[model samples]
Target: MRVMAFDYGTKRIGIAVTDPLQIIATGLDNIHPNNIIEFIKKYLQTELVERFIVGEPKQMDNTPSQSAQHVKGFVNLLKKTFPEMPIEMVDERFTSKMASATIAQSGMNKKNRQNKELVDTISAVILLQSWMDRRLL
Candidate 1:
């Protein structure tokens, strides 16, 4: 079964999905916070999602970041909506920076690199890939 990942934010939620084999993670899209559930419902109509991996924001000192509270709330909502789907939280430190660097290295235009939605989508991909890598070990 495929897996899904999300980088939760107050305004926008970035989404990524794994292949049916749950191997490669691919950036999908960014949806408004108010539309995330509906977006997922529509996506689920076509894809069989086995689980969800959400990026849990953490500070460098290993404490939960201010945004972590928001993520927790989002996770609660996700659990309520998709009760049967397993949900996992993976620490997301420096993912935004990594995404920016990745975008730069990809030779994306300056405007595209500056797009927060793009960064968020890439961050979700990175988060999912990191979790998948750890599971393989």
Candidate 2:
């Protein structure tokens, strides 16, 4: 069973999908926030996803951040759309920072680093990979 992961943002939503065995996650595309629900619904109809893992942003103090509520709403939408699929929240405190650091370390040009959509996709991969690791343990 494959699992889909989302890194929800105000303007864009990043997507990633795990292997059928749930072993690895690959970054997909960043969809417009306004069209995320439709995109997800279409993807679910075409793909064989079994569940969803949404990144839950939290402050350094472990408190829910503003983005967390947005993510929650997105998850709620997914639940309403796909009533049978299970949805889980994974802590995503530093995934963006990690993605940025990784991009910086890779020596990407300034223009690439500044691309929010690209960074968001990478962050989604980070979020999904972290969830996959935790599930293995």
Candidate 3:
């Protein structure tokens, strides 16, 4: 079973997954927030995901950010929808900026770098990688 991660937002939710060996995280997709359950159900039919890491929005002062309420609601829905699945919330403070910077530094074309979906996917990947790194430390 592999690990999965999500960068949840009101507009779009980003997805990432690790290889079966759990060595690396890769961006998977960006989907509408409302479609997550159905998307997950379809994905699970093809792959075994043992754990999930959801981005926890937080302010600079370490308090939950305004968006945290939405994330909380999503977490509740996720828990109720898949009672047996394991879930974790990891602080996601500046993943978007980091993703944007990484994309810019990668020499990606300006048009592609401007893609919100790509940024979301990379943010999810960053979230998962950080969680995995923390585990190894």
Candidate 4:
């Protein structure tokens, strides 16, 4: 079954998709947070997505951050919009940092690294991959 993952932010939401086997997650695109439900509707019509994995931002102390509230609101909207699809949340404390590290290691320039949307997309991909890996274990 295919899976879609989201890294939701106040201004933008990053999208990623997994293959039918649910083994790999690829960065898709960034969408405005307000347009996420519509984006999901459009994407679901084109792809056979079975589930959604959303990142839940947490503090270093493992407590949910303020951003988690927004994510929860987004999740609620998602559930209302797609009642049939399953939704799950994974801790995403360091996914952004990991994404930045990965990009840095790839030899991208400082200017490229500063692209917030690109970093958000990469973080979404990493979050999806982490979910897949956890399921495999």
Cα error of candidate 4 at position 102, Å = 0.7
User: Tens digit of lDDT per residue, candidate 1, span 6-123?
Assistant: 9998988889999999879999999999999999999999999999999999998999999988999999999999999999999999888999999999988899989999999999
As for candidate 1, its clashing pairs are: none
Q: Compared with the true structure, what per-residue lDDT tens digits does model 2 show for residues 62-137?
A: 8999777788788888888789998999998888889999888888899998889888999999999998888778
Clashing residue pairs in candidate 4, if any?
none
Report the candidate with higher TM-score, 2 versus 3. 3
Please identify which of the two predictions, 2 or 4, would achieve the higher lDDT against the true structure: 4
Model 1 TM-score?
0.98
TM-score of each: 0.98, 0.94, 0.98, 0.96
RMSD score of candidate 1 (Å):
0.7
Q: Which portions of model 3 miss their true places by more than 4 Å?
A: none
lDDT of 4 by residue, 29-110 (tens): 9999878888888887788998999999999899999898999999999889889999999999899999999988989899
Clashes of each: 0, 0, 0, 0
- Angstrom error at residue 108, model 2: 1.8
Model 2: worst 10 consecutive residues (lDDT sum): 37-46
Highest-scoring model, lDDT: 3
Clashing pairs in 2: none
Error of 2 at 30 (Å): 0.6
